[model samples]
Target: MKSSIVAITLMALFTKSFDPQPELINKGNSWNKNPVIAHRGAWKKNNLPENSIASLKEAIRLGCYGSEFDVHMTLDSVLVINHDADFYGLHIAQVTYKELLTKKHPNGENIPTLEEYLKEGIKQKKMKLILEIKPSKNDPERDQKLTDRAVAMVKKLKAKEWVDYISFSYDVLKRILVLDPKANVAYLNGDASLEKLKADGFYGADYHYSVYQKGEWFAKAKELNLTINAWTVNSAEDMKWLLKNKVEFITTNEPELAFETIRAVQSGN
Candidate 1:
């Protein structure tokens, strides 16, 4: 009995030692200087292919605050990183992993599994993995299962600290909170009222720049102590506006441009 007890204790120790997120979550304040998120893995500028591991690495190399990517599950339940509903005419949700292996990304990399992507992410602890869980078209069941599997994968990898979950589906976002209340989740639909988001206990809001401009959501977010993240804000003018508004994170296709704009703003140029 003593031997069995010792083995169990060792297993628990191993699990705790592997937890990737050893530090507390950053709640998006002035201290968060690294606010530039590489949308779709910094794919636009250097001709690097979107959703490829190469682009992810480039994002890391550039020292962006986060690298954003999308994930969808296969018919066999394997999770793959990609941005589109279909890959080269192959529907990701309808096919098997083996069939996917036959295809390659624009960079010639095989469609990466979630494990593969996270493994790469684990190599560098500086950047957050902005994981966007894509909703399955007409497949609500699969979407829920995918959220569960995604949370499981992150826990198994001990990457809770370095990952943030974002989704357009309210159901999926809610499921993420139910699965892990401590998770940093953002609603992507850009429609959830600030009062509702605060009431629901979400981490923040990730919406289009227009959403922020059209209403007082940014003010409400500040009033409610929620982080504000804007998506695809590639224009220098828009970036300037968000920066002035103190938006916590800016997801952009042009990380390079964003960096330049931020530097200029800081210098009062």
Candidate 2:
């Protein structure tokens, strides 16, 4: 009886579950501010596939602080998560949302609608979204439309509290600001001067670690009180560097690895 009670306690402790949501911590928004964000939703091993509901749910189960995914509008103007353009050379914008739902990836994940993703994310409240607006080369007007639609959906779901917008294009970022001035916008390619970006009105920026350049820009970003979240950070040394330098966030393929590494290093320091 004693052994059985111990086993039950261990199982209960390890199997702690929460609502499957986005699991991302917004900048200075959460108490802990866990930096590691699963890319394309913690994808499966051995090339299973990415940006699918299964992968996202798995990410939440793994206890990642957050996850990043792309959103685009279908021909029928429905929002769905997909990383790339289809064979037709356009992204979700070219296909009907119904077609996307009816189709399956090689790994057999049903393409999920943005609403489905948001619903799951909102349930947990800890899961935050780094929504990438993927505009196709074929569609010139698609960026604006995607931004408008995304902003609308976010507002409709009343999920602005848990979401952040990221993009490489300055124009798209501006559009998001116009659509909802309160929305947090992350500049994906932050190679320019902080003053230049700030003058243009940006909330924060994420850059490749290599582009950091260790120059006046880093100091400038810090001075402006801007939030910086770097990307694809996988190395312990890099996480130590980011934490030491006080970068606000990081999105990594290996969230568990990064989280463990950061906590250990911080504890030691």
Candidate 3:
């Protein structure tokens, strides 16, 4: 009996040691002052598998304002997180989640479902989730279904406040607006006019970094009271320029560099 008691105590101690403690996240409008969004969850520099849960957790640990990730639906309507249409040679749109379960990311994590991803995301309340809803290329019907399911799941999870939906498809973004009139949506296509965005009630513009370079779109977006976010900005020069221009958010593969740049700018160096 004494040996069994000691074994139980050891097991309890081991579990306690391994349990992850939630970090104290900065709250409310904290991201307003120049946020650094980790594109694909701080995966690039860390050599971690992109779009995996590990990547997401790492972003939160790094205190990124947001972690950007892509979501696609399986044949069984399970919303899975991945950047590409295919996973381990199996097409995500054509395969069931059960089939996907047989494969794993390079880091040994199974393709995470959107539900699973969001649950993980919510654990770190300070980090916003930049969810890119990838549209179906040839199937408009499937595209609509994907959008519908994504909206529904996010609503059910009560995670709307933490999520910012972005898409290259104007139609898909419009459908999201229809589903939740208050949903924060950003247009990914860099060509849209600020006036058009303002009139259509879009939350902001998440365009390519270069799109803001040549035009007065940055000034125009600010004029319209629209939030501006630029994507995949990796270079120190680009990062510094964006910071100087006062872009609201910078999505980058090089989050460490981005952070350093922001600190330098803030310190007036």
Query: What Cα-based lDDT does every candidate model obtain?
Result: 0.84, 0.71, 0.83
Per-residue CA lDDT of candidate 2, range 91-202, in tens? 4665677666666777766776788888877766556777888766665587788788888999999888778888877788889989888777878876666776677777
Q: Candidate 3 on 72-116: residue-level lDDT in tens? A: 999999999999999889999999999999999888999999999
* lDDT tens digits, residue span 65-93, model 1: 88999999998999999999787789988
How many Å off is the CA of 249 in candidate 3?
Answer: 0.8
Model 2 misplaced stretches (Cα beyond 4 Å): 1-32, 44-48, 87-91
Give the lDDT ranking, best first. 1, 3, 2
Q: Give the lowest summed-lDDT range of ten residues in model 1.
A: 15-24
In angstroms, how far off is 198's CA in candidate 2? 1.8
Candidate closer to the true structure by lDDT (higher is better), 2 or 3: 3
Give candidate 2's TM-score.
0.80
The TM-score-based order of candidates, best leading, equals: 1, 3, 2
